[model samples]
Target: MPVGRTRPAAAVFLANLVVASGLAHPAATASPYLLALAVLAYLLGLRADRAGPALVLFGACAALDLALCAVLGVGAVHWFYALSLIPAALLLPWLAGRYRQARLALVHEGWERARSLEERQRSVAEQARLRERTRIASDMHDSLGHELSLIALRAGALELSPTLTGQDRADLAVLRAAVSDAVGHLRDTIGVLREDTEGEEPTAPAVEPVEELVARTRESGVTVHLRREGPARALPPLVDRGAYRVVQESLTNAIKHAPGSTVDVGIVRRADRTEIRVTNSAPPSGSPPAGPPPAAGRAPGHRGLTGLRERVLLIGGTLHAAPREGGFEVLATLPDQVNPERVRSTGEPREESGSPASRRLAVARSGARRRFVAAFAAPVGFGLVALVSCAYLAHQLTGCVLRPADFAAARVGQDRAEVARLLPEQQFRYVPDAVRALPVPAGTVCAYYRSNGNLLDRVDVYRLCYAGSRLAAKDVLPG
Candidate 1:
């Protein structure tokens, strides 16, 4: 039904006529219906599932064309002319059919491959998202757990027997219980939310030293003072870790708000309590606040300090973060016995699993390989077909003789059938003025047999006059 498909058949029909125009005694009067029928045959051949019918149709047209030329009193068609017509009638339709089929196969394969690649990319992205979320949750547990436990300890340490009233002791007990419950709830919630990421065991991070935290802050161009009130060699593992985080967060805040100010960091360790205080001299009052994470110019997110505060409360700690006269300070007091359970992370970094870049290379290689093979094979196939066609044509044309010797045996009186046998393998025709100039016997046919080669080859022709069942005269013409 598509116009594009029918156009080639119509074009082939017109081309067949154009090629025939250069032949001897072209059928300028070739019937329109016959030409349409030939085109229809070609189209049918193209549409047929099998090639046999199409080949038969082309062969039939070639035979019928020769018969028509003889019946029309025209000279024989040259072999080269036949060759030209064969490609128009047979080759084009055959190639078109093959192209149509191959195109369909390529389209199907392309669509299928494209869909598969799309799914793979989508899956990779989803996996990356899940992996990052799991890491974030694990990081929160490590950084915030100790802070919460300190809050409960601070509440339980208050004494109301002599110095505090009864109501104050009851409130302290309620606050301690509340902070403890919140820590358990937060851990359970994060654990349930991370269940879908994987079923892997957790990895525990190494405990960080407080001195390393101060050194990193100094490297970032912050003037910092470190003062320790007691020896810290015997600190518990969790308190040592939490003490480092408190310093890290405080120094990060200092750099963000007071880019070129001096900060004083003091750590005091005792048998019952440990205190960490970080105070930073404010920058010039008119200066815009520095690279705090919540600012638009940086990677901004919700204040993780709220979660930090929650962590401190669960571990019984008192944290005060406020702006003093011309300076900002974050102070935390933690019980020496702060121990909230540590959960390790088993989730690996996304890049460690496999690279998306490597997968992209594999996909690209497959696509390129298919296209390269197709690109190389098509031209080779067409060239070989053309070579074989030319070879077949040369062998067929070689069988004919186009010299004076082809009709040398014919005499003035010979059986017509015998004289015909002696004639060259081609149609015969009368010279233009043969009817009036040549003397021909009655009830006989007189004609000139053209023995001409294509384009560059010169050949001889012969004139013959036949009467009844015998050849009355014959003459070999000039080349």
Candidate 2:
């Protein structure tokens, strides 16, 4: 399904079909009908677009061929030509069909691949859009929320002023109430647009969490009971960050909806993992009104625990936050190494206990080389064999149109007209100097005549070496 992957297979199939057909060399070496057969092969297999006419056309060609062989007298050349054509006729069309189907499959696969890439691109763009919206929401909540709170503060203080009349005081109180309601409504609206599932940062704080993170929450007036297990030790950056975020979000939630709640925070460290647990008692400030949950949380409209869920899950941790025993509890367990990027500089690379690196690399290279040969050897090997076969057939098929018996009437003092009758057509052609230099004298004008199968199925050129209208040497020469 990769781009341009179908080209080699199609090319090989097409090359085999063409080479095997023997139509490339259409000289006398190859039968004239082969060219016709080549045309028929492609037309019958591919161009006709219907089977009935193709079969009829094939039958007609075969009948005509057999009749011609019977009438003209069959020979080695005829048999070889017929033998070669049989396989090509049957197999070339099938090869053509396979090639056409493979091409279609390749095109369809390419389109599907393009569609998948487009889908992935759209998904990436959507994620970016959502991330931008989250950033914008966070920005609005921080800056605009502060300004709205300031407006309510100023309005409330104005209502307490001695210079203000009863109606003015009433109007100031109403303005403060409206501003408070607007801030609450803005928080709810922005919360809907924010999606915390996207893990923006791959790595978190590159150090262990100090006591200060928990201390700050307690300072906000929540009674937090802290519990610690195992010897206190520095954790991996990913695990450390995941643990801190769990405590941070849980404490924040307890303070927001259930102020004065007794929060019980626990941290348990082990060789392979670190765990964090936060539980809170029934709130001294009393619980807030029930509402619909945000994305993933026990209570509705609680975005804090929902955001923490993503943070915990991103670090390959498990988190559970729900109401338990008339109070809320959040628990998380983080692994020491979530991913390769999370491992610290001091972390040792894990390998198979006794395997050598050189051995592994050598094995991989051997496998790759074997695969390369397996992929390419067949096409290359077949092409060589096809070329050799074609060349040999061409050699056998090629011969002098003249026969050795045609030169039997030539004599030492034969008349020119008589000799001319005995000579084959296309005589007096050029001959090589190696044989021409020996028999024919320099001053005597000479004529070249070629013949086949006089010696070892090879072509021999006969030169009627004449001197003063008398034959001097009429010896057989190599072509």
Candidate 3:
């Protein structure tokens, strides 16, 4: 399967399982109602609807609490405390999903833009190649064709002259024959150049077996020696191609620049890697002569070497070429397990390595992996943070909601007792004065009786309440 689809499906499944388990055991209620809440929370968390899922989750939690607890309305009242969590659980995931989708869309759009740019570049390259071919054809026609035409015209004029003898006419005929041969050779050279410019046929299948390659080279009037250091096994195609190109280019170089020189080719195969080396001796005179170097950006037009490099690189191999011990040498090594047929079918020679399609596929796979990592990381991180925050808020709500009611009941009982002990005549002045003088800690709300023992107004003097070591709600009057 493509990488993009596999990871997200796994993440959704795992998240559902965790959310369900968390909701089921809220405060030791083992009732099936609570279990049903867990299942509902899992479903809601996984789906796309934000408000609906959150409402359903909240309702399920409240209903389960109501059914199990003996207190009539305590569960329903407590449900209000859970309202704060709805936004975090539902809205956060939806927003994150939207953000992720946007990010993926942006990446795909960028890739498409890049592909368009590459197509433009390829078009420009093809135009440049065509222009170069035209220039070469024009130069060949002007130089070789013009020279042959002039030679033919002068020879014809000489043969027709009145003073010319039979022997002179025969010499002119031989000269014409030589000029014709020159024109034919020039045409053949031009044809080869044209074939190269268009996408011409491949040279030939690479000769296998070092002996066979050496024998083939010998037939073309060049002397070649083949050497092997280890027992030979059938090599991978990439290895074979690299070795063949090294030998072929080395032999061509020898014939062009060091005519009549002997070539030495070596093949060595080890358990881990195979190596090929080709060397040709220096020119006969033993001293390097100076001449104009090959044209700018042209390396003897050796397509074989270029293709060999592509083949090696496709299979994670390496190649090297340089002067070695008074001769030029090319060397290459390839790993053992590479499929030779696949390398040949894919390794086309161009001005660069690999086709555009292969590179695009590689880039796509890399992008998908990055997206997958990001997809899981965001939600898992957010879910953990939400869960921690939810537990903390629930704890705070328990204290905020239940503790105040307990304190109120305690304070009412104490106030009733204080009123019962007060005397009617003395209570008016003394009772109010005593109540006013009583100390209360922070967060204490108190009701005090007047001297006459009737109900007095409530005081939200929580700041006046205190315990000895810890601050807590305190009554202004004793029970």
Candidate 4:
């Protein structure tokens, strides 16, 4: 058996030995077999989780033990002691074992719960770090990419100077080439920083006003329109930055995909929310669509929009990009007051329902609750069973007890029917053989009764001898 099983077994054996030492009288030859049998019964009870089987075993053992005691001619004290063994040796040990099982189950469940929480915390932390890193990478790509584009544009303008030397023109060409190479390197670095995420956010500290952004796009040869509504008040940093990004990405997409197409940008700031809408017309009839279509026709699969959506969502906002009419449109709505910290703290996605660890923890917690209930309920069940058993035994013993007055009233040669009126309904079954062996008249059958109703005493017993139907004799045997 496992160690857990073994300890209860040892406890049961020791309890049985304690009971047997006081009650199980050795045979005349001083044999120890009866004590061994009592110990075995106690161990058996400890191993039985159900009360039905354990109670049955205990009842059988008690019957067998009392029978042995009667055959050996032991006293009423031995009978009482043997009966005490039922609760002390068997039920107590069984209850203790059950309690131990519940305690162990609860401890194991506690450990499982702790492990599950730790794993979830680790997952949340890892996801938070990844999000932060991707956002930083996106910021670098936007700010750096814009600066490099301006440098290349300036270098190109310098190359067209009227009085430029060949060496100066060569230097301008080299600077443009270097700027292009740096843009490629920056794209590669941004891809690395995005990890598996489709896109990232922009973080340009220098705020470019909407008018300036429109002028810059016009300089790049893109036809653009800008409109603003509502009060022109200072916006939160997050909202202002997000608004700039929406316009910047929209103009960039228009320049790449709908070159020479008319672009319209609208910004409407209400008391509660800021709305941005960007739309670009179809390209010239012969021009092919520029850049690739978003994967599965989804906005998030578009790299720029994916990062844009992330940034907008972090600021408690929403973004939508899709093809509309003969042009593409991007719409964004941002709340006036951003709570990015709250969003970042709570936005980490989790798979509690689908996670194996979560399921295991749930099961462990359920089992622990059940065990706790069993721990409390098992003892009460045992007490009820014991109480009923004791009540039944008390009833049976009460019926078998013979009062001293009834024994004294009996006379020799009285009719059996007349003597029967003074007798209890049942005989005391554990009357010692030594008493039974006492000399009596020939051809007499004997019936025994406990001398008093007291359950725990070793008082004398009353034995009545009857021949056929007549009371042949009556005697009080020493206990």
On residues 194-272, what C-alpha lDDT tens digit does candidate 3 reach at each position?
5332321212244456576567557655668888888767765545655665565556555444545678887788887
Question: How far off is residue 4 in model 3, in Å?
Answer: 37
lDDT tens per residue, model 1, 1-479? 24326564444445454444444444333333444444544455445455565456456556655654556555333443454444444455454554454454455555666676676678766765675675577466545544554455445546324678898987877776676566556566665556342422232355667787677556544578999997655655555555666776676556544645788999987768899998989675554233212325532111334444444554567778878778888788877765333222222222221555545545555644554454456456656876797775444444344455656667778788777676556543323333235555567776666555342353455667777777877766554
Instruction: Give all TM-scores, in the order shown.
Output: 0.35, 0.50, 0.36, 0.61
lDDT of 2: 0.57
The residue ranges of model 3 lying beyond 4 angstroms of the native Cα positions read 1-208, 285-315, 324-326, 339-479
Candidate 4, residues 276-388: lDDT per residue as tens digits?
99999877685423333333644422566666787787678899999888889999998888664444353344456667656765665675576457655866776786689
Candidate number of the best lDDT: 4
- State residue 442's C-alpha deviation in candidate 2, in Å: 51
Ranking 2 against 3 by TM-score, winner: 2
- For model 1, the local distance difference test gives 0.56
Q: Candidate 3 at residue 270, lDDT?
A: 83
Winner on lDDT between 1 and 3 is 1
Ranking by lDDT: 4, 2, 1, 3
Give the Cα-based TM-score of candidate 1 against the true structure: 0.35
- lDDT of predicted model 4: 0.68
